[model samples]
Target: MEIKGENISFRYNIDSDWILKDVNIFLKTNQIIGLMGSSGSGKSTLCKILTGYINNYEGDVYLDGEKVNNNGFNPIQLVFQHPEKTINPKWKMNKALNESWNPPKELLDKFGIQQSWLNRWPNELSGGELQRFAVIRALSPKTKFLIADEMTTMLDAVTQVQIWQNVINIAKERKIGVLVVSHDKKLLNRLCDETIHLNIPFKIFFI
Candidate 1:
């Protein structure tokens, strides 16, 4: 994706507290970079700014060396903490999945999700199942760079590991750029090629 952000800073409101401050970061194409921080340490805020969710920011974000013009959907897509929030409750799995464009039918089998689940509603699925669906939906046909924001936080440990495995496998195979934002040090270490700690100062490492 070749992303770059220069001194990025953001505040919720003018008089309110700033979430991110003077954040400078970049990502090369086809690399998995982890964004790690404590809760409320501006990890989510950084994702938002990167994805153009909260545009009223202090600095510029560039994709492929070009300044990100404020468009609706980012080339850099996000997988939210809760898959249910990203997937529509009113829509069936197929309908929700279709929102991302035409996904290959083979992908469902690859993810170990049955074809029957395609006709089911979001409420009918387990958290892990929903999360898997969300991942496929996000990565299927249109995604370039993914900002996975605590994507497995709601899943069980077993499911979390499985999902991460699938993601890492697919990411490597596709050579997709990934920015995984999480508080789990272990997951970051396992899944990311490089990890960055978004603390008082950003500590980045190639592991």
Candidate 2:
């Protein structure tokens, strides 16, 4: 399976400058690709566009040659930098997780989610714990591709390694394509099969 973004362009509004313009990207299920760019280069915006979060973009996002459908459960899932923003404050952690899909106990363990944390509200747990849930939530069986937008930026070094290891393992096992967007070149180098740089000119180069 593959996710392809063709002639993609976007801006905040008519008055604003284009953050992304005529950008094209492609990812295959067997590859773990990294996307890097300077601030304001629209890496996050492109991630949103690819995952159907930003529907007003100028071009098309296709999955296996068909236009992506955003109506129901999205095959392309995104795990954001701030996990707290993604979860509901009123719902318990378990509900937030189960809202996507019920993952197995072993999967939960691999992500370092404690059984007790599931019973607590989003506010009750630390950011790292909440992020663990967020990552797991995006790993539903129905997910065909995952866009990690600075997914581990807030976590400590140890936690970052742990989470990425688990996510990569599961993604490989399920043949899910992964797009990792990050500013840290070293982390990208360590995790990605190939890295694509999104420069100020909106040009993409594979390294």
Candidate 3:
């Protein structure tokens, strides 16, 4: 399976400058793609467009040659930099996680999520712990493509490596495509099969 964005372009409003323009990208199952850009280059915006979060853009996003349907469970999932923003304050961690899909106990263990932590509110857990849940939640069986938008920027080095390792293992096992958007060139180099740099309005060149 593949997710393809064609002739994509977007701006905040009529008065604003285009953040992304005529940008194209592709990701296939079992492949890891890295997207790099400086600040204000619209890397995150493109991720949102690909995942159907922002639909007002000028071009189209397709999955396996068909236009993506935003209704129902989205095949494309996005994990944001701030996990807390994605979780509901009123819901406990377990409820938040189960909303996507109930992952196996071993899967939870691999992400280092403690059984006790599931009972706590999002506010009670540290960012790293909450991020673990966020990552696991996005790994639902229905998910075909995952766009990680600076997903581990806040974690310590050890924790970041641990989460990425587990995620990569599961992604490979399930033949899921992954788009990792990050500023860390080293991390991208370590994880991605191919890397693309996004220039303003954007020109994408594979390396």
lDDT of 1 by residue, 1-207 (tens): 577888887788899876777788887657898888777788888887877777889988888878775465557777878787778789998899878577787777666688899899999999878887888877864567788999888778887887778787877787778998888888888887788777754423321
Which parts of model 3 are misplaced by more than 4 Å?
A: 204-207
Stretches of candidate 2 above 4 Å error? 204-207
Cα lDDT tens digits, model 3, 122-159, are 99999889989999999999988889999999889998
Clashing pairs in 1: none
How should the candidates be ordered by TM-score, best one leading?
A: 3, 2, 1
TM-score of 2: 0.95
| Candidate 2 least-lDDT 10 residues | 198-207
Q: How far is candidate 3 from the true structure (C-alpha RMSD, Å)?
A: 1.4
TM-score of each: 0.88, 0.95, 0.95
Scored against the true structure, residue 72 in model 2 reaches a CA lDDT of 87
Instruction: Report lDDT per candidate.
Output: 0.79, 0.88, 0.89
The alpha-carbon deviation from the true structure for residue 48 of candidate 2, after best TM-score superposition, in angstroms, is 0.8
